[model samples]
Target: MNDTVVPGRGDKGLLRNRVVEVENLTIRFGDFTAVDGVSFSVRKGEIFGFLGANGAGKTTTIRMLCGLLAPTSGVVRVGGLDFDDGGNGIKSIVGYMSQKFTLYDDLTVGENLDFAAGLRKLPAAAAEKRRAELFGMTGFDRPLTAKVSDLPGGIKQELALAAAMLHDPEIVFLDEPTSGVSPAARARFWGLIRRITAVGKTVIVTTHYMDEAEQCGRIALMRAGRIIALGSPDELKDSAFPGPMAEVDFQGSDPAAPIERLRKAPGLLALSPHGMRWHAAFSEGALMDAALSALPVSVRVRKIKPSLEDVFIRLAGGAQ
Candidate 1:
């Protein structure tokens, strides 16, 4: 078992037990490489974030782990066993929820849970017990008779999660679970994620939301079918952009004008708009002097921390 955490785990160090291991993982389709030499390990009881833009191979990687798709190359180990030898066991121990809602719209919450339990072959009495426990865990108060389609987006997502966990899977993969939900709903959904980990279940999530990425114990940033960056959020930020960062607010009619001007300035590594202000990064030492001297005195500039988005933009070569 490889215990090392690539670039390293975060401050909490909650992800100490390794469960999923991928090495030199690659998948191809004719002339296109869907996943190219991707490798990473996920720890038990940790929230591992898999981040990338659309078509960046995040979903492809997840599919391989779930045994839904076979990799063209590389080794995938789950639960201390290889996928090839443990494919059936892996299927029984892991749950996957795709981006789209998979539950029947006309099915009630309880009915869906029952169907899920049937898929898992849970005994009738055990299924009832697990259903009640999941409802309590998710704070789902809707009537058992209420249709899933009539529920709010947040509640529907909750039901979907409950259905996935009906089999008591040790590892769960959520592909863009909070894609179309409100901020409040997203927050509530993250709360559910925390609860899942608290019970000793490991979660692997793929999300476009940076804020959601911040919640993970560690993340593997993928791009062009490869893992370009891997580490805790803070570690990735520091590693991606080692130089100092500044936020400048100028009294101007157009934010784009300052951005364009700063882009051509000497020693300016990268600059992007941040709400009413603009965040700029400068290289270390003497380079900072030139980048700052070029700024207009009329603008208000202050030192600021480099954000994960800034780091991603720099490492991924563009904003995702």
Candidate 2:
């Protein structure tokens, strides 16, 4: 309520709204199951990440939550109202930025903003004020008359976000908003997201980028239409693999032999190819050293911190 997105319930109990909730939500299309009994809750103002590979049902689940598709079974509640009974109500209170850029390429930025404002039924004067505020927040100063196609990818994304929030919706759903943006632009986009949360609006985003997962307050990792892991970044990493990871780099010979040796080493839980090197996970203490020793003398081994990508790959039923 103070216009800042706090994680979970803080000392102030600020996130009482529980902006989005799903329980055993399942969806199927002609016998192909999409979202399979997924359950999660997002607190007001928090950034909740829905992570999955391509074709992992993220879009299907989002559609159900947005009321664009009715679920085959289970329940969904948004903004304290049941999705079934208050689907339209939910739509009114929520803003969604789809994976594809939804702005009209042929229309000027100002025209698109005007159209969104009209759909939301904002008064002309209020629309002007909102546009000014949005331009100021996004630091986008191109003439509003310029066609959306003329703007850079980052600017287009910024405009889409501004359009989505035109009605000051209680919650925003971003489906891979940074997919095509440059690294610098992605950073800028995240800055905009932080600003939205500063205003107490919850943001639920799905992203395939593991580095982006680190940005969320909590991440739900999905696999084959099921949530295989869920927790804060550190919590998930610690609980999933309680060990120090080592990367073994070797040249002048095929790395397969040493990799296979490490795989069979005691206490080694998983071994994977990290680019040209091999990344091995082993529990802390003597076992890790033993696993390192198992590698051939030609291999150069060094301890490295396990990244969210590594964690995701391990949980997605991949080898190590």
Candidate 3:
């Protein structure tokens, strides 16, 4: 992804009839303010991606939205229900999967499902039927008699998700659902997310992965309890780093020398090392020729699209 920042018009009524509406949400603990005056909305059936660095208030905002915590001063509405009126109604309509795997490791898969069902006050027969459906959906044919601890990481996550959604909530809040899972397992988990959205369930997820943010229908970039940027992937890229980017790699020398040289080159707006290579963004026709000409004979360079990581770095004033 290119780090180009595209200019954005203020938020419009794009999500006017929002399923989840937050207005000037703020949360504070004693003298420390966790979430500032942040406001955003999630439309029905939309996959909304919440993004931020550590301590950026992403979790605080989520907690407030889920009715797990009340904002110091702000209005929040979930599924058109007022959050402060009574949390019970809201809780019943929303499902949540925290970052930590919250299943009882000692309990069998069936037992876990049953426990969740019982908490939701589901009928015995209904809970049994739902358990079978969940197993089929997650591709877990293992006996429900097997303990949760006996399952692999991927299966554990799947079962957790199934449990969270057992009551068929209208909205699901997933807090870094793929945090510790393997790449393949992450992909499978995303598949389940798609399936949920296909059935008209709104998914509000928070993630630190730039690639994962790109998969969302729209995203909000947060910092210190405030939203720094919010828009589609392309919009944010275009606004944050409004230029072409080139990714350069060398066969011999370190990227530092080329990076420093590129910084002084004309038309090059930004240069930073990403892993073993260097990424440089340039205004159109600025340093395209000069940068290429200045590279060492042992170096190789190629132009690539800007990414979310680049945009975030630039917006945050190069603070990785």
Report the poorest 10 consecutive residues by lDDT, candidate 2. 1-10
The reply for model 3, stretches above 4 Å from the true place, is 1-17, 254-257, 317-320
What C-alpha lDDT, on a 0 to 100 scale, does residue 151 get in candidate 2? Answer: 91
Model 1 agreement with the true structure over 109-136: per-residue lDDT tens digits: 7788888889989998998898889889
- Which candidate ranks first by TM-score, i.e. highest? 2
Looking at candidate 1, the ten consecutive residues that score lowest on lDDT are: 1-10
lDDT of 2: 0.84
CA-lDDT, candidates in order: 0.84, 0.84, 0.83
Model 1 residue pairs with clashes: none
Candidate 3 local accuracy as lDDT? 0.83
For each candidate in turn, give its C-alpha RMSD to the true structure in angstroms: 3.5, 4.1, 5.4
Task: Give the clashing pairs for model 2.
Answer: none
lDDT of 3 by residue, 1-320 (tens): 11222222335554444778777788889999999888777888889998888888888888777778877887778887766655676888999888886799999998899899999999999888887887788787778889999998888988999999899899999999888889899889889888888888999999988888989998999887789999888999998778788888876577666667778888877777788887888886555767777888788878788999988877654654
Ordered from best to worst TM-score, the candidate numbers read 2, 3, 1
lDDT of 3 at 318: 68
Model 1 alpha-carbon drift over 4 Å, by segment? 1-16, 253-261, 264-266
* Candidates in descending lDDT order: 1, 2, 3
Candidate 2's residue-wise lDDT over 1-320, tens digit each? 21333345345454566777777889888989988999877888888898888888888888788777888888787787666553787788888999986899999999999999999899999999988988898898889899999999998999999999888888899999999899999999999888888888899999988888898989998887888888888888887779888888897578766666777788887787878877788877589898787667877889888888888878885832
